[model samples]
Target chain A: MAPKLPPHHSLQHSSTTATAGGQVHDDHDHHPQPRGIMRWLLTTNHKEIGSLYLIFSLIMFFIGGIFALVVRAELFQPGLNLINPEFFNQMTTMHGLIMVFAAVMPAFTGLANWMIPLQIGAPDMALPRLNNFSFWLLPVAFTLLLSTLLMPGGGPNFGWTFYAPLSTTYAPPSTTFFILSLHIAGVSSILGAINIVATILNMRAPGMRMMDMPLFVWTWLITAFLLIAVMPVLAGVITMMLMDINFGTSFFDAAGGGDPVLFQHLFWFFGHPEVYIMILPAFGIVSAIIPTFARKRLFGYASMVYATASIAVLSFLVWAHHMFVVGLPLAATLFFMYTTMLIAVPTGVKVFNWITTLFRGSITFEVPMLFALAFVVLFTIGGFSGLMLAIAPADFQYHDTYFVVAHFHYVLVPGAVFSIMAAVYYWLPKWTGHYPSEILGKWHFWLSVIGVNLTFFPMHFSGLAGMPRRIPDYALQFADFNLVSSLGAFLFGFSQLIFVWVIIKCVRGGVKAPAKAWDGAEDLEWSVPSPAPLHTFETPPDFKPVQH
Target chain B: MMNPVQRTVFRSVLVLIAMFAFAFALVPLYDVFCRITGVNGKVDERAQTLVSEEVDESRYVTVQFITRSGSGLPWILDVEQRQVRVHPGQPTEINFAFTNQSGSALSGRAVPSVSPSQASRYLRKVNCFCFDEQRLEAGERVEMPLVFQLTRDLPKDVNTVTMVYTLYPVAEEKAQLQAQVAPGSGGDA
Candidate 1:
């Protein structure tokens, strides 16, 4: 028979009571954790795997950042000084591939792994073993990718887009290795996404209805679905690339009756949704952070969810916007241009909702809140530039220019990367059982803000002045901006060390945190103990839907 | 029996596999889509009825021909006539001359693009060299014929259509595949 529960604990664990054999037991026969390195190697625990992913992404961040600095250092002046154009291309390409695939994406996944189960009052991810596999595959994929640098012709120099012929016939001998590595990474993403979707849909606490789940959980659910839908498409495109390169197939070879433009079609079909895959999770993170720091319930929660869904759906239609200057027909260009512009409506709804969430609320400028606000402002700037690029005729001028570079960096750095930083600061106390040093976090945030702007802002002017991207050197006319941008890059690159230091310091020891780390934060995650126990919600917590 | 969690995971895996198949399906799907819409300048291959069904003599469209060779293809390509004016539905003939600049026998394929791409939807090719591969001996020069007609219903604003034929070097294996498919074939009709 189930033991009678006290009213307070009863409300939270109602679902536990609903289960027929829900009585708590010591369960002394639990599997013992292994010793040392093997502990992390073989653990199926979500938190442990989450830590591994977070650590891996951090390492990838610095590596990809170093590559960026190499590009910046080379472009510091008008003439080639630091490296040859060949190495420069490799740096830019690797920098993009690593930062997108390894850094920003895995960082989001790490947060999801850590927070989803806690927020939903579940014991762990639905498929914990799959979670471990996903985290492990990342390092393998990235290792193969970085190893290409040592190959005879260096790594993939043909831009991260890897437009065909350049990636096919004219590709380096190491291109095969690149394709293989991408396959591994794609498998990891697809498996990870499956785990997330299953966990979210099937593993929620009893009585925790769909709408009752936190925005972070909701956003990740959508993001996971998007991942499942599109990562396969990425796999498909890369597979075709492999067949075209190794086999005598003409999938992209025009002489073989294959159209090079077809590759772009397939790529952007996956690529456009890919942009949202990176950002939707950021939306979830910011929504959670803003509400907590504002000391109020999130404004327009339903609209926020709708907006994210609309953005995901609209993402598919606007892919051809990326090909505007690729010589699409007038009707296609117009259709894609209009569809791309329509995305701004839903995106605007999200932005307006964030500001309204803050309006007239008792707001605190915590580290997470600061980053979230910066994201709102800077991501909007990127959105405006995106709108400008959406005009098919105007795109002819901005395509392949630093303007495009600046646009994406604004969205990524402040938009996605900043949100990840905000999430880390927001949840570090819960994870570590100690509050991080606020002063150091602020310094990190300010420096990052300055560094990001300094580095990317000037690219706009240079690009508008007809400076193309992926070049090691440029005309003397663009020298001043390049110098300033490089200086900013170095400053931003080094400033991240403070973030690492802050996390380490916090983990070591600091001000003790209560179960509710933040006074205004409301979620199932906050209901758990600080330094969440090794096994959480083993008997699923009772769900009492929070009242707004 | 699988638990609810197991069922959901199994279903998700199925969806993922289906999507992977869908991605490959997109290749043929895109081809069919382009053929139907005539977007992306994909020329429709279905032979049109030769009855000269609807001829609009009142409208004359100026079609400009542009010919070029892809880099390192070792071929010089030119159109017999740079431009021609033809009444709607009236079959027009143009010739593209190709000279193999390379010393060895080479195989080449021509891809046709109709621009202002909007006009491609109404630009019907009765017969063109783009449908087949052309193989030439060293220093061989061949003139290929393209017979086409402009549909009467082509949007009134599109008074001019530029057709560009880009000659690309064919892979040896692809050339062999082409030979296998159609043996002893020269330039088509």
Candidate 2:
């Protein structure tokens, strides 16, 4: 599939100058490349920018992990042994904020940056400069957010949701900074989403139709739309917060003719879609991995795509499920409950497609496949709990409890985070020209699986047993679950160090991979050389659509 | 001439801005939705001049009044009558006594909500103290009247309506009064 390259080793420079018709002319390296730190700071190359995003998210993952560990340590034996209630609140808040905005979202974006162009046979992201700009904004945004911890009032003590009145009238002086940081992050996400949309819509190879594109690209295209639709709602909600906090507006303050419940409405409107934004890409990644390892065409490719689009649509309708305990009217409660339950149908379809794909095919449990299988089982568990919570009456029992914690953590940790680890293992051969160490990868995978389940599964029982979430202390009856959860958290947290070591080892040296890293991998990405030349498909590869 | 890539980005940015506006739009939209559906237990702040004369005498609804002082408001509030039984269209009057317990002058505004929130629309206030802020001198006490009538068309299943009035401190009024008292000192508090 390799089109003969030009004799000179030319960098695949996407034309900075946009000519008419949106045709990106490939330009060879003309100017001398800057060296060292400047190369990363000034580069607009998609691969470098992708690496930057991944690295940044990795760093944030550890930071957020440490915060989680802090909370877990405090909950180890129950009686607020390590931290005060205020600082505990900060830890939980910061942990959530960092994981959602800084870690998971960026990791997906990073993967999109690295894989989308390769899969679609594009020279680079359509908006390369914008890609550079978006990646850089995260550091500034998170730095401003982290710096709030040092401010006089000592960071956001309100939960990550930053619900009103607590975040406004009673919030510390540092909340304004948290708002600003979130604004910056929202802008970054908007720009990044726009870039992905532009790239996916405009940069596919000459013969590659929308349906012909890989699942990752398709999922990201939808995810980008979700981001564009909802990130601004987040911006708007936070801006309203800014007004309420500083401008004497009562957007959320009851004294000023504003209802605090309005805050929940606006928040969940943005937030529910944000949840999908994190997971849809995981679906895309797993869809690719399952078919590859199972050695069979995905059983229901069309159904999978339709199910994904339907899930995105249903996400908008179900935001109120999160607010069931806040006294929503019965009709509204029914509307949200029915809509929320409706979401399970599409989600179930995707899960069924995955299982059917594996039903009779030759399957090997490569590290990526192992994680993908775990994702399928555990994410379904999460989905079932979500369905339980969707029943408004049942939600009243589960709301603000460890059950809610267990549900989301099940989906996010095993579901989304595991997919990322899977993707890293799946693509490391392509990115680094070497296979990741199988023995170490298995250890990392097993420990993570055990640690994550141990950490979250007990929360289900404890939550059902009536242990509320976000508290620094627990009753003596809840002590055993807390201890086990805390130990599991530490184990899961440390296992990640092994993941980092695997990545570093793979990048430096291992069994060298060929152009097609995995035998069953059939995407346009496999057409490129391993350690994929800094410039791939500079001259567009003639894409041959494989009949599934 | 804008390229397709540039156009997609431009349109996406528009969508982003539109969604931001939509978020703010939700505030008024939510209010309108609540007003139409009576979802959030919000009682209409405007006084209703028209009171239904056709009384539903056969059906009686219990009207309960509950008063709460919000945090930071140094005031005690009491109702002269805790509960009243009235025909749906009959006007019912209740007296609320407010006492400023703080040493300094203080001002507060009352916010009202009705339980069985769907019934909020049917319970109309002919006149209420919640329509304006009340100010009191140190240790001063005042009684305010609330006259309301549940419209004859109140939901059949609803036999009782609870009106909860929570008084919140009005900071702006206190600041203005302080500025009037001391011209030299900043009234920024």
Candidate 3:
């Protein structure tokens, strides 16, 4: 007979008796963990793999941050003293590539590896070995890209977007290496996405219908779908560039019956939605944090889900918003403008849902919530800037300048990076069964917030006053703003070190945590034991649906 | 309940089908999308300027071709390179021929852009397909040829409009691939 109770231990097997020592054997089997170095390579455990990815991402984050510090260091007093202009361009490009692909992205991926299955009541990822492959490919891809910096002609100077002709015949000798690296990264993304989608779709508990799933699952599911949808487009664009460089194709050359403008269309097609891929997960993290800190069931779960899907659909139409300054036909321009404006509707829904979730609820300002609140404020600032950029004619001026730089940094730093930090604080208890050092986390949060604003805010004025982006050096008029931004960059860079410190202290051991770490935590993740083991939700969880 | 290993296999097979179905639907959906959004490659035409007239004044001539385009990504326009024998230091006009075979009407202007890779700026235009877009409305046919001169600004030898252009398609498979792949690429946590 299929024992119908939701897969828990037999009452006799679950006896409260302890073994000879203090260890409990009612549930866990002592699978001798392979000793030492061999463990990471051969291990298929999701948590182990997640820690590996997280540590690797942090190291890359600092490496990428050092590059940002270099860019800032150059702009500190203006006459280009620390490095040559050419090298400076390389720094900016490398910084962007490393942060997006290496730091922010992997952080989220690591979190997903650790939580998604636990959150949704699955035993393992839909694909385990492929998980190992995806994580392994990252190091290889990054190594190739970093190696190109040492190449004869120097690494890619065309910026992370790598627009062509600039990336083509006019490119550095290492452009080929950059292209190959991106290709590998794309492969990794596709495989990883396939695994996520499968796991979510098929592995939920019998009663955990889609709506019953946590917001994190929903957001990641959407994120995975978007990845499957767009990573290929980026690959295609890079492939065309590769061909144009080696073979003679006019995909970007107008005189050869090709248009360079087409390259922008293709890149932004993948690029614009890409920015969303980075942020939507942040929204999910904040959603979880706010409810827990506020002690409330999320006020409008369905609305949040609808809002995310709407934002995704709208993401495709609004891609051309990035190309507004590139000069398209007038009608095409108008269409993109309207499509871009429509996104605000769904975005408004998300913001409203979050506020409602917080309203009237008992609110606590934990470190995660502190980061989440800052995200709301700063991310809103980024959004408002985005709205301003959406206006067609205004974008002509803002297209390739410091204002755009300010806009993205605001979104990415306080927006995406803050969320990642928030996630670490929020979930560390669940993972380590201990609260991180509250004091250290606060220091990290404050320094990051102040540092980020100082770094990015002044760029708006310099951009308005006519300083272009992606340039190594700037005219004297733009000096002071650059100085403030650079100082902010250093502060922001060092602030992240505190995150490393806090996480280490928490993981090593701190205040003990109970099963439901937070009083208001309602997700299935909390139903399992904290310090969620090598495997969990080994059967499935049972929970009553939160009635509307 | 199945053992952890067995449950994983059962779950994996189920999830794979669901994901494949989801990805499979995207192609037809995306195509339907292109048709609807008119994100389609478009066309606009403009009246041409008779930018050229053979001058009888300076007997010295140079022959060159110049290329220009409505799009930014380079396009592969079929340029027929022919040896147009001209006198040294003579300002001579050479006609360069090009065909736009792409589904979208190709728009481009050519200047003998390749040389000492210099003097290209003054390599003026006569007639260009890029005078406006040639809307090859689907199977619509159009010829985008160019006319330019190798200016006597030649130091004894510059003579060809190796107008190298790189063409970019409106969309590529890689972008489509990335779109499909990125979300699932991360860890299971």
Candidate 4:
């Protein structure tokens, strides 16, 4: 058999029969319908799918955000203002489960689905049915999971982590559905990853080398590979839980010759890579935005690729860092510690490169640039907190506390989520054929920045002061920080409504956009017509060949 | 030619795939490894008998349990603790059964999760099945087993070490959970 293409490289696929023709053909089969919902379900069109992903994620984002708001409302001034402890537990768990799995992740995957083929010049996803299958699985999985809230026992009150004993013997009746839903989600993720890998490897515009591809495509390529490698492990692990609950196995039981701690080991193994799965695409998006807005060629593109790859590899080896408080062996601890710390190097490389990319360049603070700038300041802060947690001894204090919570939220919220917002702001014009209202966009941006920091920043203090995670009620001393966080959460949740308004206004038609939305934007995506063609790049675009 | 990033991506995928395939083939391969080392938990078939008729002054059979992997999750191998006295050439049957009580899936084939350096050759009714790759939903319970023969040809010196079938939860279970949870905790949505 021919060697399978490398999952992360090999863009610029050689198309077989039909081409989208000159003017950058869309990499899809079906002709696009500029009209109805049928354009989404029956259409194999990449742009349509991408739009659907974005729209679906937005709805889920708001739904998940509502859950966050309720969480905040309850904790606003302490003493359960809006919900009981059980309801709070359900809210927090479902809030998190939905946002990450249903909202943010799907949004990014949508961006990738739409953009990857467009940028790389593919006809359509190599496996179209699989793509549909992946997206369809989301509703089924989340429906089962969200439906659990109305169940007799209430949804999984356990944290999203759902550790053993907590999810098993001690869990409510809904745990079974949660596990099965997760199994389906895992299957979806794996299928999505495989499709991405196939598309990236097999499809690309002529004369575009792997190194020559835009950073967004490059980062997603690695992220996709990470997804494929770990999702199956997730399926395998969940299967064990299924057996332990219904059948009779001692995998986690010491008395029956099983170890409970073993669950964590397996969990983190997939857990660590999963964090990158969320962020790596964001990395790609930020990379694209910064360069375009700053009016400069990306600095050290090759090094950026290496840094991303290194981050992915380091992710797998350092998983034990999360369990430092669980008592890993001294040698194992040391190894994980060093490995975790080393990630800082590659991560630092990315930060420095972004900063350098902006230096001495004609930088304008467009809506996209505004979010990009915020990402730099905030993501670095998140990274610093991460370094602090990497200290095994210090983690003993930070583990499961609000401090740890603050650190990750800083990374994920401002870091990953912020980048996503920026990408949408940047690409909205390309997809809609009109510019979103800058005034509303600015309102959305500033409110979100303030709201995000306000919501999560206080978590660090309360955590440092010893407020553990996952408990519904807390001591009076932690009341002040919780109040601030809750207020910030509501503000942040409301702020997003403006973004939806801006996007809707743009799509309905304001001022028609030009082929290249931004003056400084340099990419295959910009070479196409506004509101990009349905089946783009049926034929590859002409471009200068890479010198190297 | 692909650069280092591409090469690393390619190589790592192969390595991971190979690991998966290796994990899939764990039951038989692990058993073979154990048997080769005399750690297959099977007493020698042709070796001189430990329970000799001449030495009927109180014959005994002992089992041992040790854990080299999967720290602190409560894994054990239970043997019927009854002392049975039998005449020479009489065959006795003992069953080693596995029970998983943890909420997550436990991988049966992890290097050190199951065997304490004893009989590495463990057999199930099925081979290369997803049994070892267990995915336990909440409230899940399943049993695994090791069926063995204590032949009349067993060596006499091996009498007291308890036979322990260790348990190990696959690494991905908790890792995935933590990943899911951390994002949920920090997520804006």
Candidate 5:
């Protein structure tokens, strides 16, 4: 078969050779490019597609954030305040679905699309058209998902987990649409994961060995595998749900000779690995940032890789821990509890490795470094709470409570989301050809940290004080913590506007950046010109494996 | 004709499809697993014949009966005995009455669960009302018998086993089929 190349491949080659002096130039101008929005709608270029993914996710983050504010606002005084209980459930559900599916997961995929090929010295993703198809599927999926709110019965109110009986028998009329939307999203994820796997495995530069690849690439490769492994399971479970709802099957309906507990099992089986899929790439991003900011070779690079792999493996085993309150047998409970606790060891190794990398090193706290540091501390806090929740006996008390909400939000907002922010700040110079304003960047970071903490920290107290989650109102005893959390949520929600402003400001104009933006950075992506040309590595760059 | 990149994509896609199949496979796998370990408290569907064996008089086990009506099922279930103390290996009989309050005919099925689920396998039932649909006409009432025995080797730590039977309304079409096949068969005894 003839080698698949973009229509502008020859023009891209000419432009690369034409710019030997390494000055930043628009390669798209040299080539006959599609005009207007058509460029984005039909572009096969990885970098453009990457930008599309990022822009799309940023918009979704705000949308999901607004939904969360609705939920928080209602809980501000805790007495059917801003919205009714039914609408409140919809807000919470939509917030979780949008953030996890649209915002966090896609942001990671966007970063992967942009950086993986460049980091690995490849021209573009192995299947560029498939990449475009995958990214486009997300909007269609979410639009259908959001449109369900207007479909008479409201959108999915069964929580993101959408347990059976509640999600099937008792669900609203719009649930069929919810199932269809989730199916589309699952397909997009599987396709995206396939492209990532194929690109990493087959498109690495001639000399770039598997172990020699950046931690981001390694983590994403594993994450892609996880996605490929579990996304279909999600598809299967939802398909069963569809059958139960419309076709009169009993995959999860207890009334139809099916077990409700089975739904929890199947959902968590996919969900547990899904948790790692979001965070493993975050690990990759933090690993990349810490070494650059610390100006040190990453401590225990091999262990870091092994720890990630072990965490992915352990993720599948520990899923039953989520079902601890569902009256699992003692043996199954003990088994899950022990496996869940065992996950902490590998996670702890990663934390210690990051700290050790920072130890006595000539370290500079750039905006990215600040976020990375917070990720290390706060993610560890999330991990500790996870360990607490892993104890079966303890989980019975903490399950379906605000503490569970707090634990995950701490990990997701500070852990995964923080890592994404750090990555963007670290790489905005490369993508925009301008140094982001340090003052503005720092302002965004501090406000975000405070807002995030204020929003989630009090949840721990309220949950322990007997406050249940997914409730629109709580008793007066839990009033103060809810007040603090609501205020914090709003504070955190609005501070993100500054993040968008930073990106726009940096993109429009800032201090012009050199080819190597960070003094301590060492990666193949750094070798490319800033505001990376529309096409990069058209001719493969010789890669020298770093001596650890 | 496929290159290595295409091959990798092909394999990943295969993994995706295989995992989908694996998910569906889990349904039967879960059933088999539950049956083997009794982790889900699902007892055997097949009835067992009464086996003549010595009753373990040294041990007394408490068997508690709880009946719940599922949503949309306008039926009242009354268990003659709430709790029974019986010797291991001794056969026990319990009577349960079902009354349909609805104005029309309704068909319902009872789903049973044995709590402290590990004890599910040790509790053998020679006869059960859960084996078939319980169809009743307007204001009709029916009484049924549940004949069961606890095995002689009941675990010493398991002193109490709770059996919960939840009754669910069956669809009208299936209820009509049952009426045509077995008319007035499971009525008051």
Candidate 6:
């Protein structure tokens, strides 16, 4: 059992044997890929599978956006307008589900799939077939999730958190399907996470050390670990819901000797870490973009990595923060409050580091850079609101209010979603061999920033004024803010079309890109040709340690 | 087929299955938490040893008995007297009357819940009919006895303690008896 050669060495060994003058090297016998739909179905190529994940997530984003619009439209002017209250509930529920699970999470995973291999100078993921399987499972899961709308009693209206009793005894018949679909999605997430961990650990270029890897990869490494640790817990809770609904079990029935709050304990045990899961990758994306645009090596790269790991660890201890209003003991509430606030230290570290990276550097506001900047300012605002929500007493007022809505949207839209847009703008030239139109890109960026702020900022005023969330109609006092929010939502939603146009134009060919597309870009990825070769790094690039 | 990566993937899949089972495990885990905290006011199933020497004679607590028939069971249940005044640590007994109003014989169970759950742990039971199921023939009427004592350690602020007994038909068990009872044969008078 001689040790097998490294993949690159083996490729070189096999190809050198097949040709006399090295003019005709054929390694396709080992790495043969078929054409057309079967390529996506049967191919183990990371880039192709990455494309699949990105495309799928983009479609889900629109679907979720539409659901949010429906919610916004109904809340536009107080009285129920376009949709019935029941459908509005469904819209909010589905919007949350699709956005969190189907859109933002998958989008981050897609970026990981596309960039991790290139950045690490590896040929492909550690287990490419498993990667493909994970990618394929998402569509199946979401399709099943969407089909539940046609269920006899309608889709899940128990809110995205799906607390028991409401989700079990009183839920529509489609609740079972919702649980099963979530289970499928959970399985997909766990599989994808495992693949990511394996790839990062096992497939880095020969000379690269753990500290030497990009911040994006570091954040993902922690995020992947969080996924592995928590997604299973999510599966566990949802399965309990399934049993309570189908079996004669009393897991959540007080009448049958079960406690409803227990369901919340189990769900938040998974749910809290899940919120970090959504945001940590955004941290990574912003970390990557800020340094590049600022023309500096990232300020305190080691601290960034430590902060990400700390946030992940702290995430587990603070899940009950979401349950403060549900009657936790004073000691328990204070403990959760302290732990939740402690998260601010590392988060503040990350924000401080980004600003320091930007200070006194030759900064330029390209589309990606602009989005990254907005992410910094707006995500911090979300963080402050989160800190307020962490104070158990203050949260009594903030919980389940439109203020809570405003807080998370600030983090998610400007925070996570903005970083995603930035990642696209930063990476598009690399993926497509052409640059997106600068004029159109800036238009998309400005509209998105304004639209996002307009949509979510007013909700804070409405929330502070005591308007509750999830209601289709609000009191007359809330009418003005709701109007502003709806108008902003429409503006934000419509402005995204310009982004689509930019991407399509780029992919169809515009300005040809050089090997290093961005002036200040640093990494193994930029060392490769634009529109990276289909099968890159047959021989892994020699590692050159980056200088600070 | 069993490459190292495949083996790792397989192990992750096993962890998933184990976690799925663990979710179900939380049901019993939650019950244990409740029991330890006495949070839900679920009385212990068996008799608790009484602290004989700590009886409080000066304080009189009002003990109220409340009974109601659960949804499907046609058992008429009520406490003969709604309330009793007793000293802490002194044993007390109350009679609850139950009648099977259904046309056929049926089995039933009564579950007890204590209000002001903070003091639930201090309400010790000496002997009670709630410990077992009671089966009765059609039109059967019987008086059941409940025996309990409040510990002297019960919070001073809790002056009144209400114990509610909700009687539920052991309907599924009754259905099981049907196969043994042979539906058309001598089940009814």
Residues A1-548, model 5: lDDT tens digits:
11333233433332452232223343434655556777778777788888899999999999999999999999999688778888889999999999999999999999999999989988889988889899999999999999999999898999999998899999999999999999999999998999999899888877989999999999999999999999999999999999999987889877777988999999999999999999999999999999998999899999999999999998899889999877778888999999999999999999999999999889999999999999999999999899899988888899899999999998999999999999999999988889998999999999999999999999999998879999998999999999999999999999999999999999999999987899889989988888787668876777898876
Higher-ranked by TM-score: 2 or 3 = 2
DockQ of candidate 5 is 0.65
The per-model DockQ list reads: 0.45, 0.57, 0.04, 0.04, 0.65, 0.32
- lDDT scores in order: 0.85, 0.88, 0.72, 0.71, 0.89, 0.84
Off by over 4 Å in 5: A1-32, B101-106, B135-139, B170-189
Q: Report the lDDT tens digits of candidate 2 across residue range A128-171.
A: 87888999999999999999988898999899999998999999
Give a tens-digit lDDT track for model 1, residues B1-189.
877677877887888889889988888888888777777777765555444657887788899998877644667787888999987888888888888765556788887878876788888787888778788786799988888988788899988999888887677634553444353433321
* Local error of candidate 4 at residue A234 (angstroms): 0.6
Going through the candidates in the order shown, the clash numbers are 3, 0, 97, 86, 0, 0
The lDDT leader among the candidates is 5
Model 5 residue A309 distance off true place after TM-score fit, in angstroms:
0.7
Tell me the spans in candidate 4 whose CA falls farther than 4 Å from its real position: A1-39, A546-548, B1-189
C-alpha positional error of residue A295 in candidate 1 after TM-score superposition, expressed in Å? 1.1
Which has the better lDDT: candidate 2, or candidate 5?
A: 5
Judging by lDDT, tell me the better candidate of 3 and 5.
5
For candidate 2, write residues B1-189 as lDDT tens digits. 777887887898888888888998989999999888888898788998757488888999999988887755767888998999999989888899888776668788888999989889888888899888898887789999998989988989999999999988786774564454353422222
List the candidates ranked by TM-score, beginning with the highest. Answer: 5, 2, 1, 6, 3, 4
DockQ of 1: 0.45
Residue pairs in clash, model 2: none
- lDDT string, candidate 3, A354-433, tens digits: 88888998998889999999998899889888888889999998889899999998899889989998998999998888
- Worst lDDT run of 10 residues, candidate 3 chain A, spans A13-22
TM-score of candidate 1 against the unseen true structure: 0.91
